[model samples]
Target chain A: MNAVIVENIIKTYGKKKEVTALNDISFDVSQGELFGIIGPDGAGKTSLFRILTTLLLADSGKAMVDGYDVVKDYKAIRKRVGYMPGRFSLYPDLSVEENLNFFATIFNTSIKENYDLIKHIYVQIEPFKDRKAGKLSGGMKQKLALSCALIHRPSVLFLDEPTTGVDAVSRKEFWEMLKTLKEQGITILVSTPYMDEAGLCDRVALIQNGKILSINTPRGIVDSFSKPLWAVKSSRMLPLLKELLQEDFVEDAYPFGEFHHVVMKDQSDEPLLRQFIEDHNNDSAVLQAARPDIEDCFIALMKN
Target chain B: MRTLKFILRKEFRQIFRDPGILRVILIMPAIQLLILPWAADYEIKNIKLAVVDHDHSEYSRQLINKVTSSGYFILTHYSSSYEQALEEIEKDDADLVLQIPDHFEKDLVRENEARLFMALNAINGTKANLGGAYLRTIIQDYNRQVRTEWIQFPRFSSETQIEITSSNWFNPLMNYKYFMVPGILVILLTMVGSNLAAINIVKEKEIGTIEQINVTPIKKFHFVLGKLLPFWILGLVVLTIGLTIARLAYGIIPAGSFLTIYVFAAVYLLAVLGLGLLISTYSVNQQQAMLLSFFLMMIFILLGGLYTSIDSMPEWAKWITRFNPVSYFIEVMRMVVLKGSSLADIKYHLLKMAGFAVVFNGWAIFSYHKRS
Candidate 1:
């Protein structure tokens, strides 16, 4: 059986239907699978997580976590599932040790009972156990939060943007931690706006405007891009983009850190695109053909 | 039950760790108890008086001296004209104008009765009424004195006179502090209980930690109980300190048993704390919770008969006070402390408070949404 199932969840807000936060959302995450819901801000990621965690009621639909219905079996679901919200939701005035011990006690367990699950993360923060949780650095807080969530030995863990504000190195280490947790046969459903983090998941669902755009493996998503894409650069990057969009074969062009990612009509060749950019700009201009990535696929899906 | 224990433990740890809230809970009530009763005293003294002694007789002069010596009035004006005395009252310089008619003693000796006119500034009706009543008692005493010395009839001496001697029960000296101390203590307990309880849950919401607890398996009733128990215990502690200060500073001990006060307080705390939790559940943040609690508290205290008598209130206001939990507690405190009334005397009050506890907590638990 799947660890999490969300079937046709719909949610709206405002008295006049001013916002539709979620629209006909449906997905399933298998047991022990690492599922990623990738979207930008206002893409209804938090709303979906709240619905599945039983914090909010969906306007219409059904969801089940740990084989228990989100509504009817909320008490049973609450015991077996662990949820870390998008924000750091622990007591700030409490010490790190106190926070962890309090959460463990409330779950009717002790720290010694699940020390193996959190030993690696707790070791990094154990030295500052006396300091208040609010005084700790961002990376330490993230690790401490993860330790608290996993201390209960839950069968399914839900992390909502766990690494949104951490440093790059900490983000990498956090994803590594998630991978280890996944290996221990705990199904994980994590959401983030960062496209690079999608590569760390086994499968990802691209969501935008409260609707699911596509759900596939990161490699599969990039491989499915059916346009001739290339990276174009010139001495004046702004002018190159302006001149490229005026071309008849240019489908879309966007700046992707030092180079501009250019997508042309299917029949257009890379050689013709390179020649077009070189003739319109200075001699310092350069063009190179490159493989598409997850970001490219997201942008393509959003455009379609 | 185990979940409730853990939650209560967490609440206690958080409360004790923050030194600011700790001082507010433990020490502030003591200071307020010592200071507030002295300020809230309703005993009217040093009322400004203006007298128009038209007769200028020995009787009028004697009456003026008697009024000033009563210790309740300060002779601010001694005008010979009633118009001038009225001016003093109109200027807000005097609270009362005493008028002695011409030939006041001659008319009394000849006709056996005379009239005296007194004008009072009734804007502050309580002070005015009390001052007028004091003046009337003093004049009556003077009348009885004059009639005894001036009238020398052998037949009157043999006739009988009805002498009435009255004793003030509970408070023989009529000390205002005794009346005010217990009432103020009730307010202090309610303020601390409701403010702390109302802000407790909303602070968790503001910090985003409520979602973590809400998604857990802990029952909603357990959560509400956990939030209320800590403040309930703290309120009892505050009450103990307040009672100590009342005894040490104001010399007030409950005439009744401590058991009576505790029984009433425990029930009162449940009602008050439940009200506070209900406010927190509806508010979105700590500031909103504080403001909402403050608003409700103002209404509750004013209508609770702390500073005013419920019997003296208007028909509509008295109806509102019937539903106010603070009013019942105040009545219980007065009955047990001042009147030294036993449990049987306050049985009706205890039942009302118990009813309030059940209804307020039931509404709080019902309104608290565990799912959405």
Candidate 2:
């Protein structure tokens, strides 16, 4: 069963409706599936989350959460869904335990009622339950926020950029928590700007500029890249990137970490590319056929 | 109802946790109440007099002695030149000038009438007017005494005097603090109630917590009530502190029962807190809410008749005071504190306050959208 369905949702902001935040967007998530929306800053990920969660209204389309219409049955949707906004939305002055207890009581439940669901995440921050939320480190605050969002045992949870500023270790731990929550049959829809996190999700929708570029499993997206990709690195990285982009056979080149990923127009032009790079400078250079990742697929999709 | 309980708990916990809000709620009222009443005294005294006596006769000296000894005027200059006295006025040294003409005391005995001229530096209108009135009363008393001395026998006198004795009611001593303390108490209550409530919701918005609250299933009425009830109770707490200070520091126990003030305050807080919530709903951030509250408060307090009489205001200004919630509370405070008015005596004001409470809270609830 589809836990969430969005059909051509359009939302615009400003007095004259000049800034189109979401434009003809549509997607769906099945029950118990961990879905992801992968994009960079200002890519309309937050706008889509707000619309689906019923915190915002779409200019011209329809959305449903847990079989309830986001517009007409907002009250029903609100009772069944959990939303944690992109920014830190918990009260800073409240202690961690107090914040959790407050959210739980307001939802007409108690912490002990759902302690088994959040025990793993809650135990990590349990020692600092008395400390104010504002004084907690970035990763700890995110964990506490997730706990508050889950205390009510919501069937569908929406997390917008939950791991944006968290450290590498905490991000991994947060994904692990989501995996456990999914096992208990809670459908989760999380948005993040990190391309590497896309592989962790069951499926991802690549979005940019208020539009979705591609929607599929991370491996499916990578397998769909139809061109030969190469990773070229030399002693001088900046000049190597500039030299590769100047060649007509090199379709696209962008600096990815330590190597410049080069998309070639022809699969048989590798020898010509390697000889041209070796002749450009006296420094030793290495070139290899590299496999496409989600970021490479995203870059390739964005160019089209 | 249970949602409201949890929300109230969170709000109160946040309020008590922040020392800044605690100081504003508790210590601010105490300090403002203690200092404002004594400084806002309206009884004008110490008018400086520059005397240019062209006629230094016994009658003139006697008049100067009488005027100076009245405890209202201080004789700052006693030169015989009128120009020097004018210089004194220009230098801000004297507020009034008394120019006695060349009377010589012969004109009073032979001509039976004498003329005297007075000049006042009317820059401070209240002080100049009161000073002129005081000098005229003293000269008239001297004239009556001189006429009585000339009358040799009481039987032949044809003068008929009607003596009028008047007494001040309610406050016989005409104490300024008695009039000022109640008004100041109302202002302090308003500052604590309205500003804090206005900033509270916007603080949630500024820090992004309001969006989380908005996604919850809690009813709008319950949410607004949860936001309002804590501040409403805190407002009453502030009023109690103000009243205690008025009693202990100023010795101003209300002439009427405390129940009347509390009843009126309970209704008054609803109106003001409703106004604060309305402002928060319209503001996007804490700075905007603070600025809007400050602007409205300045207008309300100035026109609320705290320092000026609403009856004496222009017709247009009087219309504005009718809509001002602060004005109604100030009137009720003064009525119950000074006039010893009962609850029945202020039923009209209570009804007006109840009307404000309905209009403001209703408008606030209507405009506050759960999804926008």
Candidate 3:
């Protein structure tokens, strides 16, 4: 059975003429699989996590987490699932060990029983176990938060932007911790706005504007982008994107860091595009061909 | 139950560990209970006076002697001029003044009428009233003494009078400390309980840590109760300390049973913690939580009748006091401490508190939102 199954989940805020946060949102998480929800800020990732975790209610849909209804079996579901919110939400006054023990005690478990499960992550900061959780550095906080989430040996783990505002080392360590968690047969659903992190997941859903645009394996989604994409950059690169989008053959254009990742429509020959560009006297800029990543898929989906 | 215990342990750790939190909770009540009562007295004792003795007779000197030796009024200065007495009054040092006109004794012996003009400052109304009554009683006694020594016919010592004796109920001595310390416990419990619990949750909201609990398998009620139980227990601990001090320092042991007061404190503390939860649901930050908690404590104490009896208030204000949970506890504390009121006698207070518990806990749960 799937570890989590959500069907046509809809959550709206306010009563009359409410704000529709999640509309007809549906997905499923495979058992022990690492799934990702990729979107920019305000893409309903946190809302979805809250609903599945039973801390929130969806307006007009159903969700079953770990063979229990999200609404009806919330208590049993709570026992088996672990959730880390988009922000670090541990007690600041309590030390690292106290936070862990508090959470474990809340779930009707003890730290000794699940020590093996979180030993890898917990031991790194064991020396500072007595330090207040609030005083810990961002990286240590990330680890401690994850350890608390994992202390119950939960069957399903939900991490909402766990690596949000940390250094590269912490983010990398967090992802590695997720991999270790998945190895122990725990289903993981991690939501992140960082497109690069999408590659680390077994499968990812590219979401924007509170709707899922694509859901597939990383390689599968990247290979499915049938457009010939190119990076166009030159001396006057700032205006190069504006000029390119006004062209008849150019389908979509957006700035991608130092380059504008562009897609062409209805053009078969690559040299013909060069000729068109030459004819248009786009001489102040240089255009080079490139392959599309998840960001390209995201931009294309957003445009469509 | 174990979860509640664990939460309480964690709360005690936070409160004892953080000096700021501990000081905010305990220091205000300590000063109010220990220091303020000693400094504040509704029974006015010392009064600076200006006496204008126009008679200059033996009676005037005798009257001045009686006033000075009474210990209630200190003869600041003897002003020969009324203008000088008026200046002294304007200077604000004298609270009272006595004026005796020329031949004050001759007017009394010939016309069978005598008058002693007394002027008093009324800005400090309660003290002023008390001083006024005391001065009147002293003058009346002096007149009775005059009737005995000067009039020899109707001896003042033989008089028919009624003295309504007041037998103070449980606290026979009417020690202000006994009256105040128990009420102070109620106030301290609320400040500690509500502020601690509200700050705990609000701190999580502030630092973004509550989201961790939000995401866990912990039920919403469990999470809220888990948060509340600790502060509730902490409040009881503070009550225990304050009660111990009341016993040790003031020798004010509860006329009622310790276990009964403890049980009352525990249940009352739950209602208080529920209030904190309700406040937490409304507040977004720790500063707002602290501020709102402070406001509620002020409202509770003022309406709780800890300092002044509420029974004398109008029927409308008295009815409003019914909704105040602290009012009930403070009454119950007083009843138990002074009246030695048993659980059976205080059944109404217990029922009222239980109602408050339900109402406050219900409001807490209702206001506590699972989502925005």
Which numbered prediction scores highest in TM-score against the true structure? 2
The docking quality of candidate 3, as DockQ, is: 0.50
Q: Is candidate 1 or candidate 3 better by lDDT?
A: 1
Ten-residue segment with the worst summed lDDT in candidate 1 chain B? B152-161
Could you give candidate 3's per-residue lDDT for residues A5-59 as a string of tens digits?
A: 9899987877683677787888888899999999999888999999998888888
Please identify which of the two predictions, 1 or 2, would achieve the higher TM-score against the true structure.
2
Candidate 2: deviation at residue B371, Å? 1.7
* lDDT for position A32 in model 2: 97
- What is the CAPRI rating of model 2's predicted complex? high
**Candidate 2 chain B weakest ten by summed lDDT:** B150-159
lDDT of 2 by residue, A169-283 (tens): 9999999999999999999999999999999999999999899999999889999998999988888888888888899899999998888899999999888888888798566
Model 3, A223: alpha-carbon shift in Å? Answer: 3.4
State the lDDT at B15 in candidate 1: 93
Each prediction's total of clashing residue pairs, residues at least 3 apart in sequence or on different chains, is 0, 0, 6
Q: Considering chain A alone, what is the TM-score of candidate 3?
A: 0.95
Per-residue lDDT tens digits for candidate 3, residues B137-245, read 8888888788667666655547676756789867677667777777777877777777778877787678876666665555567678777766776677677777777
How accurate locally, in lDDT, is each candidate? 0.90, 0.91, 0.82
Model 1, runs deviating above 4 Å: A15-18, A267-279, B52-59, B78-91, B99-117, B143-149, B153-165
